[model samples]
Target: MAIAVISGCAPLIQLDSDAQPSTVNQVELGQGSGRMKNEQPLAHLYISDYDSAAVQNARMSGMKLPGYKPEPVVTVNHYVQSLMHDLAANLEILSTTFSVGVTSFVYLDGDYQQGDLLGNQLSEAFMHEATQFGMAVTDFKTTDYIRVTPTGDFTFSRDFLELTQQYPISVVLGGTLVRHQGGVIVNARMVNVMDKKVLASAQAFIPQNVVHALKGTHSAPLLQLKASQP
Candidate 1:
């Protein structure tokens, strides 16, 4: 049997909580700018970028791309699962509860050239597995103020933010993914988009074997993510 490895939800955001948060061995919350709105404090996560020397090498080494091959599916699955898991744990540490939101662009497939044709399917798969691990999406959305493209860097410019009216977003989450020294590194960050302030951040390193292996199904270790305060 095969499960749908997709990411998707209605335009409307929703969140369900099971506990008060902060469990033993939980990630610690750091200081952040108190710019989040009281009502709709949302964190919209976007795919920062996937272009890296290591990823290129992996592709050259035939790491895997979107195809019928199980290897590609597994590789893409692991990347989304682990990164979102760490991103959730790290973000919750700072605020009592954060509504998680992801953009349609996060799952980008660069036609097998430089990026993963990563889409809602991949995100859905990741979300399903991430729930078993830890990550949670409370509820969130982006505002008309900004438009985040798949640029190498997160841009905060008037060209995008100015074409808006009321900005409903609380934060924008994004970061980098790269392979180094046979290991893959994932970084996640929550920023107060309107205030130009960083609320929380997390960085983690995954083992090469763990990340590169694509034959068997493997669960992502709830490895501790290095969190940074504002």
Candidate 2:
């Protein structure tokens, strides 16, 4: 279930003013009448870009797919509520293992692909899982609409890191979801905030049976999913 369109890049790290001082002059922090005397560059804010063949081509060809529905901008409330519930659950679970406090989040590839509503739908489910685990999740969808730039990239890791450093989150998890073989797969990597190192990487696989259930049937979620962890 690899739904994400993969792109290549060098290993990522947060860009800082101290590391690249000239970047400060290049930053556009919105418009203003007068420039402030002292403006500090934000650090630990990671910027990333996500490009998917599905989304790019869908926009180009003006094509739509079956079982696809555009999410209404005016009424994204239901999706938000669903996301909150899932996020709460996820945070709750992490709390038992870690501190499980999340201040904010960013969705990199949420735009529709092939008229498919996978991104938003998956996010709602993910949020629900996070909430169930007992975490404080931010409303990134409403508060911040992380856009797909012309270069087809966006950044959120730096912000994630900053949150971790400030709040001293013991562990931080980040990942992507993709459609693969008529199903969906989520690949996640958990890192130690202090060391800034990856602690583990896991893949959540959704089988064909589970995918059918994703279409709105209650066919015993993950009933046939078998995984091994070390």
Predicted candidate 1 versus true structure: per-residue lDDT over 133-216, tens digit per residue:
443442232233445567643323324434444434455555545545656565556666667676656665656555534332
> With candidate 2 superimposed using the best TM-score fit, by how many Å does residue 135's alpha carbon deviate from the native?
1.8
Instruction: Kindly report the root-mean-square deviation of model 1 from the true structure over all alpha carbons.
Output: 24.1
Give the per-residue lDDT of model 2 (tens digit) for 97-173: 55332222222355322222333454555455556555544433232334578887543533443233344347655
lDDT score for residue 174 of model 1: 54
lDDT of 2 at 115: 21
Q: Pick the candidate with the highest TM-score.
A: 1
Give the lowest summed-lDDT range of ten residues in model 1.
1-10
